[model samples]
Target: MELRIGCRRPPEESVPGLLRYRIASKIVKRQPLGGTDDEWVVIEPVYRAIELLEQLHDTPAQEALLIGRFSFNVRFKWFKNWANSEASRRLGLASIPDGPANLRMLRRTLSLEMAYRPGGVLATKIYMKHIAVATTEGCASRPGGAQAELLAEVNQHESERDLHLVLEEFRNYQEGVLPAGPGARSLTEFFAGIDAQLDAASAAAPKTQRNDRDVLNLLTKRAKVLHLGPANYCWFTGPSRALCLKLAGTPTVDRPLIGMCGSARCPQATHHSGHRSVWAEHADRTKIFLGQLGTTRKTERTRLQADHDRALRVIAGIDSAIAIEG
Candidate 1:
């Protein structure tokens, strides 16, 4: 069986949503009476109706066609299960991952058009936000809810994933594919020795937990590890010695802020080949911004020049010696 959502609504079915929905939506918007905002009454559902569709005309904005008006999340799980089923295997599609990206990916594939997209990671957040009814900064957490504990648990698993990536960099260092980072030679040696065992232990953990915490604990004595996502690595031992933290004058922070990183002078930052692209892009962006600045903006140009130079230094240091701003 096949499911197809037409790109354009049939001519006879031009208006997709009820007029009542548009009226209520306009009322909810609380516009000044008879304002321009009164036009195009908004259509919001429990889940996004237009996310996977490339609708060309006024398709009922709130009425989803796929799988009988269910949320995309529910439909996504159903597709995932189907994809992994024996039928899907016989159809030669057993290897497709059940990852989040596959949800709209399948839709786009079936619809035969590229999905409307912004930045990759940024777009994912936009999609989630679009599907949600409302988003408020203050509504981010609840003191009485289990959400905080769940978030902490999620952070632990993410940390392990991040550590494993750093370990991969160390493995490359061991193979002479890269050079050592900013740390005592003893600590660097410790990094090279145990990445494999920890990885194995992580693989052996129960499927429910992402990694074995016991395995991760083995690095506590040697590797003062903090994975700085795009910036690079920080073998952070103390905040007093932390350049980024000290520059902020916030003594409470025991880590690099990446945004305010002064890795060129810091003693704890490190870089590897994996961080080259980000530093290089930073240099490129700074150079472009500098070029576009007017002659009168000397102060801005001076700061940008420093930033560009620092980025270049970080790039050179990735395989060689500033601070991996990351």
Candidate 2:
């Protein structure tokens, strides 16, 4: 048996009728009002009766039909989930309120008209690009507007000076606690080491628990090891971020930074609260061990100290070079 895939819906059918039929068919399959797939078979005759005019008009128009082109508009449904807790069972959906609508149009110049001859059937294949035009007023209830304003304010203040200063301050905090030596590394190195550690832990996790506690614990550990003050940081580190999600397709050279925060506050704060907990407990330890910034052995203390001092100078110099405006 051969399968024919029509490129577009019949043009003789009104856009509204075609869309209604498409949506109604999906609804029936989805059993939105409640019924098994078998129930659809029973109710299909009634639906056909309701759409008698469409069927009758389509049959005659399809015969010996010449070249044609057409377009359509449609409305659809989507749901947004709202969860109540970090560990919860029940999920609430917002129903997208108005379920915004979109429009799509296509045109085709057929080489031959096959609608007229015996055993000839007008078959269509449609390709549509749905562009959303308007949305329900309920969408305004979201904080997206406020977020845009906040982001604008942040962008205005975030001079290169700020990045340099932040790195400098971070270095100072590390140096004050650790012995001076050539062992110091940048925060990026520190995080990169953590990534390796997480990999090892994930590998060691039992297969059965791989997707549950074992993985969750690993993430929580990572978040803890890389804690940076109270601000939230959203790093779109190209492949680095993708690595965390098991999708290391292509790598990037320079990491692009985009600030996505409200007001002057860092956006990282708004991230899931438990993220830190997961990273610290399971992932950071792996990185620290793997990255090996310093060793506590007394024999290597002097050597390590010297290395630490050199590293601090680099960080401090980099920091001192940055000028910040109040």
lDDT of each: 0.54, 0.32
For all candidates, the clash counts are 6, 41
Query: On residues 64-138, what C-alpha lDDT tens digit does candidate 2 reach at each position?
Result: 222122332311221122222332334442234333334321121220122122211211111111122112112
Model 1 whole-model lDDT (C-alpha atoms): 0.54
* Root-mean-square deviation of Cα positions for candidate 1 versus the true structure, in angstroms: 18.4
For 1-326, candidate 1 gives per-residue lDDT tens digits of 11123322322324675322222111222346542222122234411343344243245344234333356777767877888889999999856564576545653442222112222222322333323312311222212223335467888887766667655655565565553345434345665567566566568874644343554466544344564746666667677777777888886875567787665566776666767888888889889999999999999999999889888877775656223221
Stretches of candidate 1 above 4 Å error?
1-142, 179-217, 220-224, 294-296, 321-326
lDDT of 1 at 234: 67
All candidates' TM-scores? 0.47, 0.18
Q: What is the lDDT of residue 314 in candidate 1?
A: 71
